[model samples]
Target: MKRSKALKVETMFNNFKLTFFLQPLHGLPETLSDTANANWPWQQDINWFLALAEFKRLTQQPTLHFFLLEVWSEHTRCLALPLCSTKDGRYWSSLTDVYSPSFNIISSTTLIIANPWQCLLHALTQLQPNWVYCQLSPLRQEQIQQLTKLNGCLRTHVFEHSENWLANCSSNQEYWHKRPGQLKNTIKRKRAKLLSSGSRIEIHSQLTDELMLKYWQVYQQSWKQPETDRYFINWLANYSAANGMLRLGLLFIDEQPVACQLWLVHHSKAAIYKLAQDQAFDNLSPGTVLMADMVNYVIDIDKVTSIDFLTGNDNYKAMWMDFNFKLYGAELFNINSLTGRWLWSKQWLKTTLKTIARQMHHLIFRARHDN
Candidate 1:
């Protein structure tokens, strides 16, 4: 069946005589609320915040199809997947927006399906999303294996691998002892030097709109690029204030803000949202000092079980994180669609050219070194 570009796409899929409902975020199954609240973090509220923030962009001014799926089967709701289909029905993909790093498949504890991958594949067919792709960071070996054997009708590709860092903290003393001795001493030394110079350091945990503006002001002084999502951040700040989920940390030096971080606390987990440090205070290591203090607060005061540094595995993150996980990208294409077939061919050709170019570069470098 072909879809008209103007009509809204909503339907149900069937496999093994069981129907699976594919609905938008608003049409989630009644049982999902308890499951989501128990299994996921505050960030998973992507339905309300992230989706809303990107709705207009994804829809292309009301000319495209955009929906985050909440899939339900006969007995129970299995998972929620992010999906975006273009107006022409020619382009469709898994949602991997800039703001969210992990397009994770959150499952309910009630899931009892024998072959989840097969069921998911059948459900996906109903949407006719020509191409479905997502980056699964830190996926388990078993999950990747299941995805590989999803179905013979679809071609699946595992594109890349990356890493994410996370810190597991139980207490202040434990966290302090886990870090390298050199790091501990350096932070202490910096703190002492700043104090001796009459510079005071303060931590701000609550973020009112007024305080967020102060953070934005200090962020402007930082070395990072101009924030493209200030509006989104402001929206998040407002949501967080009413819910009491915000943990905005600012390192002030004698009444001037130098470094800041925004963390969202949900139950026992705290995820770092955004952080910035003034380049002028680089020598003072305001960012590092601020991080150390925040770590202490997260562990000692908040008593959170874990702190996810989120998507990146930078040198600084490695220094602080006790462990790391791998991230992978997967793309699945439907063989039935002519557009899908054409896109797959173009993708293969592009990949081939890149591979050949890399090989040529390697050979040239080798020859130059020999000469």
Candidate 2:
């Protein structure tokens, strides 16, 4: 089957058996309840925000087919499956499988009689695409393996877990107050110096669209390059505003906006959505100051349960959260087929090479730093 240029949601919905139940989860509803759609820091609903950004990104590619799979239930909230397919290249799909036993059951059953490992398996069987790609949390490795064994029609790839740090303000003051000793002291001194020097920091619970747009402009200036998903900024600005999820924290040095961060607040947790800081204020550690202020504000003022430093596997995340959630991605294929066996061998070779290269790079960097 040839990939279609124009992807109609209705057509995609009609092609699948579970479409009627899953469509609403993808933001197809005429109206969504606050309870159902309320933003949660680490919950799957936040992916709704991520998916829209992804969808808008793919829409820019005039030749690609974009399809979104949304799933919902009273028991579990909304989940989105954003997929992009191109005739000449690989098909890409966002991970929609929630981390739960029920999801594992459904996925396992589907693979028993299906060619592929996911709901997209049905679509792939019908469409016969070159490849179908999906991202899964690292914690779901067991489930992925199970599906691959059942279907014998997929390959698995693994990637780093996007780290998130959480601290409950109401219960654990120590966690909220704690930070890396050196970094914490440096930021504390900076904050004290700035306060004594008459600088002020302001935290806003809600942001106006105009102010959010200003932050995006600052982001563009900071990067100084166009990203593949240019529409992401606009989507975030609008979605946060529409859903009352926007939290803008600004660090002003003598009444000038030197640093700013966009955060999402939901279900007693706050997530660091995006950040922008002026290059000139780098010496003052404006970004660090802003983060400190947010930690305190969420704990003392907003009384949020936790805050997530999403996506960066940085050293800072390790210091903040004792435990981290691992994100896993894999390719599943039939081990019995010659093509599948060949693909697996090639992937294993590539992974081995990359691992060796990474270790070599780390050693070289460490030696240089020690010198």
Candidate 3:
């Protein structure tokens, strides 16, 4: 049976209504694909990797529900977001972080809900989800704040999630110019040293099957094991072949492969999915050199508006990226229920302990320095 519902929301400015349909990935839906591609551009589109069959085969979690949420005006659909929920009514999280770097509610334009938090709470209350709660992950502060403010029944918990780095530039020259002077000089010096040693770096923007296999081989030489799922890799190979969105860059020393990066690009945005380099070539700074080369490709040739380092605050990312944004996780607990109350109490205790620990550490450090 097709499960669907519509709710009307009265905002101060306008009366907004939304339609939601349950999407079971028994097969790929054109509507799902169209909505994903149309709305989300900067982030990786979910439709690219997981199909209905794949999702069913991989995610064996019980009580799972997938929703295609559409906000419609009188004539046209204004916004759409995909949501997953557990049987107990909790938002479905990733089986592993490597599988999905971020979870988001996709929309083409900035969401204009007169009071998004209240509206969302009202919808949830009406739906009467099995569990007294749901949690959305990998959102920024501003996005989480919009959903955190609810009335009496729902309590919110926001956790420190991940840090992402990004560089916004029009051209390679402009990118280099934006970097700190010291870092710029260091990169230039490293490039000069590698070139002087007869080592050449190459980027394979055009991904052929053979070339992709080679890229994987190079990655294995440096990393412990592949963090990405096998199914994901299979999907990526097929997707890249058809879409031409994968960019693999390799650094070579006298024709020997040393470092490799797998980048995914769509529309005008690009993200570094994975990067690895041979430990033996550590002295050559192959990873850094390869990154520099990839940046040029992303900006100069690909003409990407931004490059996301994706979910890390590593020192190297700071060197290249001018700014960063925070990703947060929000858990909405039902204050009316016992289980929800217990969970909230435990969460509160954890936060208090963490705060006390930080204060103690600061005091100890101050005491030592003062002496």
Among these predicted structures, which one has the highest lDDT? Answer: 3
Between candidates 1 and 2, the lDDT winner: 1
Give one digit per residue, the lDDT tens place, for model 2 in 10-88: 2232233333122222332221333335334223343443454344445554554445443322233223344444544
lDDT per model vs. reference:
0.64, 0.54, 0.65
The residue-by-residue lDDT of candidate 3 on 1-371, one tens digit each, is 23444434423223555643334433352324554444232233546424423554464533555554445445555454455556444443322234456765544444476664465445554454434656766777787887676667777889888898988888888889888888767778888888887777767656576776666667677854753345555555455445656788887778777788888776788888788888887877878888888888888788899988888778878888879988888887776777777788888899899999999999999999999
Best TM-score among the predictions, by candidate number: 1
In model 1, the runs with Cα more than 4 Å from the true position are 1-36, 39-43, 46-64, 74-76, 129-143, 201-205, 345-371
lDDT of 3 at 53: 30
Off-target runs (Cα >4 Å) in candidate 3 are 1-18, 26-32, 36-81, 87-91, 94-96, 99-101, 108-112, 116-121, 180-198, 237-241, 352-371
Model 3 has a clash total of 2
Tens-digit lDDT string for candidate 1 (1-371): 23322212334334334444444432212212343354333335543424443544533334545554555655655666555556454455555544565655656656556666666656666554554332333344566777778766666666655666888878878777788988988899988876765665555555566788778988999988886556556655655545556778877777788888888776787788788888888898877877888888777777898888877667877778789877666666666777656656777788889999999999999999999
Local error of candidate 3 at 336, Å? 3.3
Question: What pairs collide in candidate 3?
Answer: 63-87, 88-131
Q: Estimate each model's TM-score.
A: 0.79, 0.68, 0.77
**TM value for model 3:** 0.77
Q: Kindly give the stretch of ten consecutive residues in candidate 1 with the minimal lDDT sum.
A: 24-33
The better-scoring model by TM-score among 1 and 3 is 1
